[model samples]
Target: MYDFYKTISKTKIDIVYLGETVCSKRKLLRRDDWLEIAEQLKQSGKEVVLSSMALIEANSELAAVKTLCSNTDFSIEANDMSAVQLLKNKPFITGPSVNIYNPSSLKMLAKLGLKRWVLPIELSKEALSDMQSEKPKGVETEVLVYGRLPLAYSARCFTARSHNLPKDNCQLRCLDDPDGLLLSTQEEQKFLVLNGIQTQSAKTSNLIMDLHELINLNVDVLRISPPSKHTEKIIELFHKTLHKAYSASEANRALQKLMPAGGYCNGYWHGTNGIDWQETTEEILCQLS
Candidate 1:
């Protein structure tokens, strides 16, 4: 967790999101601890937002979300409607988990004091274009431009089940894999990653090549999910790409070098399967290897 925070700080990320978004069971950092980190980030002259658990199963989790929504030190990124309801009439950011597919939903949230929102992973450029054509007044759009695509959320803890443990008594086994556990098919082919209750793609979907396209679409921010390692490098590549200091080819190469195994994918941006890499070059693969 410190590694993740340090990477963001060193990279000079404009906004840093603290708190666990996947499972509440992973409690290396508590609310107060996260708020303290937020204060440190603010002291460094960066905007900080606290994120709530994506799946709010129990009242305890809901209460934690409420605390995050009510925290005055930083803005809240509402991951669910419960949070949105709590943050109503207060300025907050909408996380990608909140399905704001249409303009009406977005407008409603904007009316409720939503200043920025992250688009869902499945949303293509065409969908973003349609949504932006009627984007609510003063609502900034953010996209999950880089990272492993969070495929689905399940009530049952996949991480616990993998260890043959009951969900109620997970023994905090998820802490064993900081980056998430890799799952494979019967043929032993790597497929998806089990991130507590969330399933993510084995291949990290990147949009360095689509940076220009996203800029054209008027995307306000590009979110890069924290990876296991070299997160600072990924942030640098994204920053350079956004500033036009790095060419598409160069950024793509940098991304390929940063990720492991299955490599860079940008299919969702192209309106296809989220695992497909639209642009590939021999030089990139050589550098990646």
Candidate 2:
């Protein structure tokens, strides 16, 4: 984990999200541990944002959210309303899990001292264009352009359910699958992944293909969600693609080699089936628009 942070810190990526965003039960890193990691990343000249959980069921979880919100050192990515309540009137970024869909929600959040926000994964390009036009002054936007899309969050632990064990006594089994446990269909096709309470797409969502549109839209940040492997190279490829140092087609080919098994999906960005991979081109973009 330390090595991963060190490698990412050296990359040209502007912001790095650390800490758990899905499950509060994850204990591989305690508060002090995350603080130490944040210190290391800051030392490497990387801006770090501690992420809050998507759900706050237990009082202990709410207390943890408050602690992250009250931190004086680094900024935070608030994922729940509880975090937002604690962070009101203070500069902070909202996470993708915050259910911000329309311009009204964006305007409301902006009024609450929101400096930036991650576009919800399911929002289409056209939808984003509308939101961008109506976006509040001084508010920036980040899009989830890579890695498996986080589909949903639930209170039940699907990983523990797989073993016929209850969520409370799951024995921290999710740690075994550092990335996530792959879920397959009856036909043996990989469909989704179960990471504790978070369900993610089985295929990595690659939007290096949409670099042109994102840049055209003036997106403030292009977030490359971390996968199980090849993250450093993936970051490099995306960086090159964004700068036109490499073409989208070339980057896509290279990405295929780097992530051979994890396939790619860009449907949500195209307003199609979330799992579908729609090849976008000048002609196609014209037709869609």
- Poorest 10 consecutive residues by lDDT, candidate 1: 280-289
Can you write out model 2's per-residue Cα lDDT over 7-75, one digit (the tens) per residue? 888888888898988888787788898899999899888889999999899999998898889997999
TM-score for candidate 1, residues paired by index: 0.93
**Which candidate gets the maximum lDDT versus the true structure?**
2
TM-score of every candidate relative to the true structure: 0.93, 0.95
lDDT of 1 by residue, 97-203 (tens): 89998888988889889999998888899999999999987889999988888899999899999999999899999888877899888997778999889999988
Q: What is the lDDT of every predicted structure here? A: 0.83, 0.88
Candidate 2: segments with Cα more than 4 A from true spot:
260-262, 281-289
| RMSD (CA, Å), each prediction | 3.7, 2.1
